[model samples]
Target chain A: MALKVIDTIYIEEEIKEHPRTIDISSKFKDARVLTIGKFGELFNKKSQSFRLQKRNPALILAKKAGRCVLPAPKGFGIGGHKNYYFSHMYNCLYDCSYCFLQGLYASADYVVFVNYEDFLEEIIEKSEENPSSVKTFFSGYDCDSLAFDKITGFAQYFLPRLRKIENCEFELRTKSINIEVLKSMEPIKNCIIAFSLSPDEVAKTLDKKAPNIKRRLDAMKNLTDQGWNVGLRFDPLIYSEDWDIMYSKLFDKCFEIIDNNMIHSVSFGPLRFPKAMYKKIKIDSPREKLFIGPFEMNNGTVAYKNDLEKQMSDFCQDQLSRKIGKEKIFHCVSDVV
Target chain B: MEYSYSIRFVVALEAEAEPIIEDYGLKRIHEINLFKVYRNNLANYWLIVSGIGSINAATASIFLYQYSNANKSSFWFNIGIAGYFTGPAGEIFLVDKILDEVTCQTHFPRSALTKKIKRDELLTVSKPREPLSTSHLIDMEGFSFFDVVNRFAVRELITVLKVVSDFPSYGYTKITKNIARNLISNILPDLREFVAEAEEISHKELIRLRNPASYNEVISKTEFTQTQSKILEKLVRDWEEVFPERYLIKEIDGLKKSSEILRKLSSDLNNFRIDWL
Candidate 1:
């Protein structure tokens, strides 16, 4: 069995005495604890190896002093006129080779902003500015929402608060199967429980330490059957020799247990990364075969060639469209919003 | 059969390596002044004795590393006698943290090391003292040892092991070369356990990087971008890992362009099971 032992905990001096820090401290009683003036003091520093640090990473609890909520990139969150994202955490527990987070930070240590109320405050303010227009808040852009839920208990503390804002929507995107917290509480309708999926073959090669495809599908089924609005995210799709057949089988397996009415939305996109991120990931994971596949640079992004990208997206959309309503599907593009 | 030595030890004194050198049956191979190298061909081991002080430790570590042409899996360790304010002599501890008194900079060695031995922090000072300033173990060369070795080796593969030599009860004056050698000789078994584990880790890495030179000509012939260069390295490594008996060089000889070489390699690798090994 695995143990919940963070190699170290670098607490921010400002919030060293905060109750959330105390609660996080209680989770790993035996972790080696240290105090830092700020999380960025060590986190943003260079020359640290992300791949090596992932083997034994520390947890950093700090306060986000500025910009608690920022607008998400174009076409990120589906079914919203205005979409903003807030990250209580940076970095992730799973070591997916395709994950962009590996290149975004020099260190693999988890820097969790313990100031939840501040994010909620900004969220409430934004949602109230236009009471009639619905806005969505996307989590898991940098870290999996549920993978670290066991440690962060982010949902436990913030799920109830999310219910307070009638116009705001939440999307807990993840590849984790640890949904015990959601299973315990009554399903939140405004919050969409999105599960990122890839074919089992693609996942086996790329998604290190992430829950297997079968388990994630089961978790999605359990949530959707309980009346929770679920979303299927096939973004950054991997191309393979039998990709069409593989994705078809995957859609069949997912729809087998998931009710058509419960799936609030479905989205798919090609595997793409900003050039800088691709450059960093190439160095970080030099031996990973995923980086070895053929890719071309297009408008500062490194991804599959244009024809292949269209083929992959078209095939995946065609597969999902056969079993689901057309209105439920969305292609995540830069101008989609 | 000839054994390839992967684990290396750099000590401050010959007496520090005395028991280790003798017990491991290491024969002296290279020497210059007080700096000496020992090897046991059968066990694939290397031990170097670099005099004293941080400068000497740094120099000798680099010397042995270059002389031996060590790889990433090679383990570089600095083992010596240290004095703590309270610990009794012959007490073994792994240094998890090092504070350089002269530089006032701290270095934390990777803490993922085995817990078979007790762990402690060490403070490297310029000169010996009558009383300790902090509770950390005081040594003469740990911080410097890590500073230089870490540049060329994996942090997890480098470490500092210290056996307590003296405390307030028994000052440094009472300690001699023979006493230092004796204290080290007593903990030989525990030290062996550490080396064995480190050697085990190095052996696993050996399987991946083994004979990477087989595709050197093909890789050198191509002009790949920085990112493509890295991806090409993985493709070649994966091919070598999965089909070590097959030759990638012969297959690449007919390919004219870089794209052809990469496309051919990637096409072959796409069929591989990532966890085949």
Candidate 2:
């Protein structure tokens, strides 16, 4: 998808002089720049519509204060004893129907924390705190890691710093094909550039403004061919009458271009959400057909029925195991009843 | 005659409202005495004259909203004349930010309209004021107009548009009723285009809020508790999404209980196979 033009930029008074802020603002010379005391003053304000703001969203540059790194939720890692995640950005460029960011944030504008050193410092401190264990730090929890890289220069700055850290694995989860910076440099063995995947039909229908599945698959192939460790993520597996056939074809297409040995790991997660979040997203997007699917409240969480969940998980696990080892395939089952 | 409008305009004076009223061919509604209200016979637009100042603008907007029975999906616009720091007295601007001089509060109106029109920050003062060190467009009703209308509608559907009437070189006393009318008259074409876009957005929102025709038919034929009514509403929406070609009313025609009707609808939706191809 073509990048939407940035017509307005809100700068926090604290970060107005920051180098990153200046660099980003200089690119959009014509965009109107407004000063504010804090990003939350505008981003967290009520009466803002996520749907409407998605049409013409502004960029808010701010200095991230307080704790920059937090422990990852349980069952959200790739076999690491200590897992953590950091968000240098809030909100995504793509408007996926099932994205949790829409319900988590009231405004659809992008918030880029200009202070990247603080996040890196905390990651190093945490990794050094437990030097013996393989601590994994996940990026792109709240936003796509590389989708805004052209403007944010996220990977170009963070990859070099993260490469020097000892016994730390970094994961950049994305559905973007913005890989020019990644292709220019040597692949970091410790970093895994994970791409979120869905069936072509499903991605086309649900992942609005995101790169098509074909483009994503091609990016992964190119990165893996250049010796970059890439991972496959089939998350929030959308269910339909012919889901099995569609997913089977998807796996065949993925394995056709990407070598099995180059694949770092494969993870599949069932479509699920906290009950309150599901309710909010449903209200925000009342016409979205994905919300009207076969989902039920299970122990304060909304997910597919037990039988349906099992059928999907078992089918995906069985299909993926045929090509990759069982040890490399992880089932991301949340702590829901 | 009762007419439903999706776009409501709140102007501070009749001179500012006349150009729009004439351009849209709006007829005055005699029943609404609290505010001077005009609406087109096509039932898509309304304009109200709130006699000058922030409080009057707020109260008149509320009055027009209730009197017109506007829905949450409707668009609200505050259009009038304002003083700018350096203006030729005919420039139009879409207010992106409103700073209230008295309250020291600021509001950011979501501007989803096209960027072809120039945008400016507005300062809503308590009374008439001259240009200050800042380059903000000065007005008397923008802040309160946004502050109140936002409570009734989403910020995206709310806008504040201003046409510069006086600036540093031209004093406020030089402005007259005819000048204000002409200033607005000159921009009627652009204003009409902007309203058309807003109307299209409101129309889509209305469609999203509307349920399938079968929902009303089923509700009229059956007896349901309040909770059952909500559940049946969701079930029918799901039925429409899953099986648009199928007729839901015929399947639940003879079903008396809400439970039976809901079950039939749910079963039909569940059993239907969705072809992704």
The candidate that achieves the highest TM-score relative to the unseen native structure: 2
Interface RMSD of each: 5.0, 1.7
* Model number with the top lDDT: 2
**Candidate 2: lDDT of A232?**
95
DockQ of 2: 0.64
- Candidate 1's C-alpha runs over 4 A off are A1-4, A36-48, A128-133, A279-287, A333-337, B1-5, B42-44, B130-134, B204-213, B217-235, B238-246, B249-277
What local distance difference test score does each model get? 0.80, 0.88
Which pairs clash (backbone N, Cα, C closer than 3 Å) in model 1? Answer: B5-B44
- Which regions of candidate 2 are displaced past 4 Å? A335-337, B1-5
lDDT of 1 by residue, A1-337 (tens): 1434785788989999998989988899877676677777667565345665687888989999899888988867587889888899999888888888887887888989999989889988898887888899998887999888877779998898897776888998999888889989898878999999988988877888888888898889899877889999987788766777788888998888899899999988777788888878876555666665557788888887788789888887788889898888888865211
TM-score of chain B of 1: 0.82
Question: What are the root-mean-square deviations of the candidates from the true structure over C-alphas?
Answer: 4.0, 1.8
Q: Write the per-residue lDDT of candidate 2 for residues A1-337, one digit (tens) a residue.
A: 5678899999999889999999999988889899889888889688878888988899999999999999987888887888899999999999998898887878999999999999998998999895999898999889999999999999999998888985999999999999999999999999999999999998988899999999999999999999999999999788987899999999999999899988889999998888877877877777688887678788888887779999999999999999789988988876422
